[model samples]
Target: MTVNFNARPLTKALIFRIQKQNMHYSNSKYWDFCAPVAGILLTLSFAPFDYSWLALAAMAFLFAAWRGCSAKRAALRGYLFGLGAFGSGVSWVYISMHDFGGAGALESSLLTAVFAAFWALFPALAGYLSVKMKGPGQVILTPVIWMLVEYLRGYWVLNGFPWLQLAYSQLETPLAGYIPVLGAYGAGFIAALTASIAVEICRGKKRLLLITALTILWGTGALLRNQTWTHEIGQPIRVSMIQGNIAQDQKWRPENKINTLLKYKRMTEEHWDSNVIIWPETAIPAYLDQVQDAFLAPLANDAKLHNTDLIISVPVQETAPVKNFNAVITLGKEQGMYRKTHLLPFGEYLPLQPLSGFVLDLINIRLGNFTPGTATQPLLKAGGYPFITLICYEDVFGDLSVRGLPDAAFLVNVTNDGWFGDSIEPHQHMQMARMRAIETGRFLLRSTNTGMTGIVSSKGEIVGQAPLFQETALTGTINPMGGMTPYARWGDRPVIGLMVVLLLGLLGYGKVNVGRISVTAV
Candidate 1:
């Protein structure tokens, strides 16, 4: 009798059962939706308040269901977890759209849900594959599979967002040392492994000593990177960052332009001793060339007179008909500019223009039809030192923000978080910024429009931090240096490659073992 394994009805029946089970738990029409939502809510415990580690706990529960449950059910659970995590994590996007974008509540909420659902697929696929994949332990290749999926989601989607990864929550932990080596992706792997190992131990697996010893490997991370990434190769440069705390509604208005400039000038003047005075993303409401040359001339003159570099955020117009963004423009240090490359969808420019505007306007900011900048390359040096520059939201992506480092003396992140307003968004924003410093072997100088602006060292230590919603001038001197970390030079390739190899090994082992079982039965 000829048998077709591909036609096996067992898998189909299992998947149907899983779909039904998931549908019963979730209110959504989609199957397995509950898992993603549960995962997201579970991750909240991992945030700053009290139960952040609970994020890992939540991940563990999902991992089991993925490894042992029906593949279809596992996939559904993964997507559900993603929905919950991103639904809450990126809720800030809705604020930007509804309150600022002019998109009404209902429309913005629906779009946010759609956005969350799209990203949730990353986890859903990872979960589904974990079942198809066999590993040494239950989901032993979990970290590899997770990272592969995250990398795909972050890159495959429109400009992709790698926000709210489990690694971001552990910015302060000793395991963070792995960030520079493997980038944030490596941290995710380690964090996931720890959680999975814990789950196995909890399930009465007698591998305590082995797992305990393996976790101890993180000690190497703490020891090697206990100190700062780079030493002061150059004298400290003084910088004054102005936080205007402007309301998002009035920010793009023509009438608020003068008030915005005056507010920043006031805060900036307070730190005349500063050698470098900076502003946040699009600090100037007008385009780069549109603002009176007189406006830029003085800042340039002041930069030269003070022998300092004054960087301001403004949109720049290009002959290409694209309005490029510097977000922060350096004055005095003429030619001092680091243009933003990665653009924000809907917020910066509409993705699909034909019907995109209608969809974007629903979110409501005018989006200015801004053009994307040409190069996200590096800092525009002045006063004899190289500084890396990353605009708002740019720092959240570990790869983009930390690139061109090691060559540069320090890093600069300019952001406008006023759109979020008094939400956990700012705190989390600051938290993610700190992780970038840890990832790159350099100091970071943040000049934000609203607050949480300050200096963070290579060790991810917050040397100086500004309070949220306060209009203030933060002046500090950050030591600039040139040093390299394993992460700075190699990027995520090594960690990801390790993961891929591991997954292959698991698959091979499973295939061989299953063959042996079949043979023995015959």
Candidate 2:
């Protein structure tokens, strides 16, 4: 007898076995260990590593681990993931605190752990809510909750950290095309949505539909990348960004103050023939009043003679109720001043005062208590055109950058990232600064202390860059871009508002579905 053996049943049986194994693995206690690994994977997706695609896999792993689990288990898994992500991603905090902030190794480690733990709660909250709001459409609801928590962590909690956002990882990818139209958070939502769809497909739920949606989303982004959101209106101008390479420990010492000032002044002198000369944050190393007549006045005069604009950052001290502001002043052709409106918490000004003060005292860490500048200050003039000035940490806030819209010809950011030292912080900071350029549709001139000083094109590409830990001037030509991208015009309102509406609609639909199920049972 001829046996008609079919391969279809064997293939199906093998597929069933693999699916069973996957399901078992996801449900097992060992899956909780994957949470932190997923977090690390997400970190690798960001700058330095630039493994952008791993971001999707990391999110998928976390989502799969959260599925079919109890609220308590999900919270534990979420916290673990957060701990892993923040721990690995921002361990630079220890470098800043111990190496520069005068905190002991033990104290710095404890404080860093505390900082990471605090941010991790946001993710834990997201996981808890996802489980509580569990419904037939969990794939949709989970991602929404995740993005909401991300917004809270980045924008609301403790004056906003906004580091290592998923959108930053997608900068080189086609998804980056969404950045100009939708802003960083909006692009992040799309990334989260894609991750959710991927999880559903892995679970064998509407694979064709999910696959189609994925294709459309990325394909649209690829097409969008070719579109020019902003146009260049004026002639190209030569710009020089001075990277002082000042050591963090020695920067504020009274002994090094004059040397620092002279070094930057000398650097500026060399680039005076350029249309614009920029300095790193606190490059003056002294209050403006202290250096006004002796140093800056002559420098301003020289810049005017050369027909070049000098933009410098120095702390401005005001008496009568004593306050200091992180101020940027321009000299030559046009005179303007921009005080930093957004300040870095803990670094610039401590929050939750008494408690924060006590903790810092315990760790032996001292920080500045500078006053914030007014919100509606006029755009500063540089290279004969109005431009937005962001001092150090202010550039991290996207909405803050949008305030000086189509009126500003370009963007300038001055930073002192030496505090983080020979670490990933500077590179990560450069990544965020590039995003600001893309969002505004303007060339971003970023000058920094201790490297990564560069010129970012309107498309977010680094056109000119200085070596890390090197004292050098990065020279480049940038056209004054006019007009605004969609992100610059609307900011985050449209994207955030849509997310809120979608979440509420899903909740309402879930409630209705439950009601129908109850009626059928009765």
Candidate 3:
């Protein structure tokens, strides 16, 4: 199916060509795209939907199989391939919007299609750009394109959704060390690069050195995961993470706050033996100043007297009247607080007040307008440990925790997922957290308001966790760890910078040797 670039609008031949291309792709005209199209569709099943590494590897092979006819052809195939990948990857969004998001099947499907289309564009752009930038002599430009597109995915539209990002491949993988340095996006960039490298190697391309180089890099990460990144400087400490599976609707109700606090107190009372005890997002709903002054006064005094440290979450007001989020403090000996910088779109804050009623009506829920917190200094000290803190969905954002509090100790992430309720969304959330722990090399202690609480060491190992939708205290000892992962220190700058260099490097190489490559049937 060929597209005529010179066609005028409303021309019969132009309309016929459009119809021809559509029919070619969907029916039988464009058999050339069938393999790549199938390969792309196959990738959707490889995601969390099935969790198969073999499937991922196969997609890589298939993508390489049907690639490199011409620059325009490559881009078109890539676009078609991505349509298949994202169309299936985010099919669950339909469940979220229909089952949980309160939309009918058709409405949800349309919304999901729009979302998938946006995601597919990134990969399409990557494919097109790779060919455009690919060097003539032994080039692996697919990875370069992938990294750039992934970087684009991280921005655009309320900060791009890195969901289904390539980093998740390392969630349960041994390539954990790369995460701490490159961040998930960084790791993803490497993964895409490696896949393209593998493709080039398969094509009998020169050197085959990049494949070996990538292997050695990740092999080093595997060996290094067992090594402790940070030395212990503080005395031993313990923490009790309480998971209250309270429904989101009932969590902040005036009457329910009492039960919520009581539930945490009861579940955690026995664990007071631990040096530090933490609760999930808004485990206590009242603000700092609004707290029964008498209650907190005694609570703080007792924690100090008992030689304990307490870090808890509660919505606190910012200025005299404005309310920014404050998962405020009751730290023992020295008290400090962390305000969540990034707030959830609908859950914590409502945007465009004129449409507030319309949005709430769409979801069948009340929406709050929570303000963003100042770049509050790191408040990581607790029972002698210093760490960085992020509340709720904040853990999903890349570099925010590391950049916001670089040079801190480990990571402390508090979240409440009762709202998602028995959905795969929570598991998706957990997968992202695990990648973060790996990328930063800092011990990640995640305490969820409802469940999926755990400890992730610098090596990305999950040493402890509580199951979802339960009320209980998960007590565990964790290292107050710190270390500079490549990503932690440089983020994706290295990946992007290198890609730019490669683009320039390839121009000369392509000019010198691409004729030979074309002759060889690439």
How well does candidate 2 score on lDDT at residue 139? 78
By lDDT, rank the candidates, best first. Answer: 2, 1, 3
Position 393, candidate 1: lDDT: 78
- Residue 452, candidate 3: C-alpha displacement in angstroms: 1.2
lDDT per residue as tens, model 1, 352-447:
666877755544547655556665454677446767778887787777765666667878888888887766677777778887888777788898
The runs of at least 3 residues in candidate 1 whose Cα sits more than 4 Å from the true structure, single-residue gaps closed, are 1-38, 45-50, 135-137, 225-229, 320-322, 352-355, 361-365, 376-378, 517-522
Scored by lDDT, model 3 comes in at 0.66
lDDT of 3 at 312: 83
Clashes of each: 21, 0, 8
Q: lDDT per residue, candidate 2, 1-522, as tens digits? A: 343344555655764676576666646877687888888888899888889998888888888888867688888888988998899999899999999999999999998999888888877898888988876678788888998888888888888988878899999998999999999998998898889999999989999999999999999999988889899888899999998898989999999988888898888888877999999898888899999999989989999999999998999999999999999999988888888888899999999989999999987889998999999999999887899999997888899888979899999999998999988888889999999998899999999988789999999999989999988999989999898899999998898888888889999997665544322221
Rate residue 510 of model 1 by lDDT.
62
Judging by lDDT, tell me the better candidate of 2 and 3.
Answer: 2
Report the alpha-carbon TM-score of model 1 versus the true structure. Answer: 0.88
1 against 3, candidate with superior lDDT: 1
The alpha-carbon lDDT assigned to residue 474 of candidate 1 equals 79
